[model samples]
Target: MDLVGKVAYITGGSKGIGYGVAKKLLQAGMKVAISGRTLETVQQAAEKLGKTDKVLAIASDVSKHGDEKKAVAQILAKWGTLDVVLANAGVGHFAPIDEMSDAQWHAMINTNLNGVFHTLKASVEALKKSKGYYISLASLAGTNFFANGAGYNATKFGVVGFTQAAMLDLRQYDIKVSTIMPGSVATHFNDHEPSPEDAWKIQPEDIGDLVLNLLHMNPRTLPSKIEVRPTRPDKK
Candidate 1:
């Protein structure tokens, strides 16, 4: 598929991996609308990208039903069609299952799982119109459970299952779906600041490149699930 002139909507796009994907899509000549819960951050990122005409930044909380509607409405109003939807907005909460607070667990489930559902609910019509694509940013924890990561693992695991089933449901309409599961990405997730020590982890732009490749793949074939990791591990 031709990326140039295509339209994409990305959630949690103010910074980190989402920003990287937006930059790549803009570079590929795709018009992109990006959402963040904070207007200031979203505006700042949009301005820095210097593609005002091709980029729309909206303050949206994907976990909210109303916010999802507003976001999709804004994108549709701008581009008249949606060719891709990247449900990349997610948050992590780390704690032992026994020690996890209700707030922490709910936060993870709301953002990582419910948010994706809201995004798909809002954009499925436009996607049907364009026979577009849907991609979710899951994590290696989706399949690999770890100590102190119960909340995060549960949400991501649900995401992988949900995305896969949604893919099958949408295939009859020619709408493609895929989930990217990356291990140890150098992003400010779960309150972990990125640093040079993160060199061993996959870079945000690498995920961006991966998304571009997925978008360009032949229509007849769908590589529905992808797992990526750093080639080298940081030595202890």
Candidate 2:
């Protein structure tokens, strides 16, 4: 696909991986719309990104289908066409299954698993119309289970399965789907601050670069699922 002038929508794009991907898309000359839970935060992020003519910020909570529908409507209204959708809004709550609270478990399920569905459901028609791409931000935990990560793991696993199945279902319409599973990114997830000490971990722009690669890949090839990790994890 010719990325120039194409339209892409990213959930949870206020910062971190989403922000990095948005930057790359803008650099590639694609118009981008970024949605977050709060309008002010999304608007602030758009200002920080500094491509006023190419950026649109929307207040949206992926866990809620209504918000996602409204978000897609706004994107269509502004861009008239949607070529890419990234279901990147997610929340993590790590705890032993025995110790995890209902609130924490449900939070992960709603935002991480169900949220991807909501994003896709709201935008699939536009994708079909454009023969576009849909990518989900899952995690390594989706396949590799670990201690103190039961809730997070379950949600990510569901995301991977859902995305893979959706790929098969959507391919008939020429809409591409894939899931990205990454390990230990330096981001503000789970309240952790990214710092220079995180040098050993994958950086946000690295994932952004991967997304750009996926977008540029030929349609004859589909990298349905990708697992990415830090090159030198032992450095930590």
Give stretches of model 1 more than 4 Å off: none
Candidate 2 regions with alpha-carbon error over 4 angstroms? 234-236
Tens-digit lDDT track of model 1 for 1-236? 89999999999998889999999999999999999999999999999888799999999998898999999999888889999999999998787889999998999899999999999999999999999999999999999999999889899999999999999999999999999999988888778889998989998889999999999999999999999999988889
lDDT of 2 by residue, 42-69 (tens): 9999999998999999999999999999
lDDT at residue 27 of model 2 (Cα atoms): 92
lDDT of each: 0.93, 0.95
TM-score for each candidate, following the candidate numbering: 0.98, 0.98
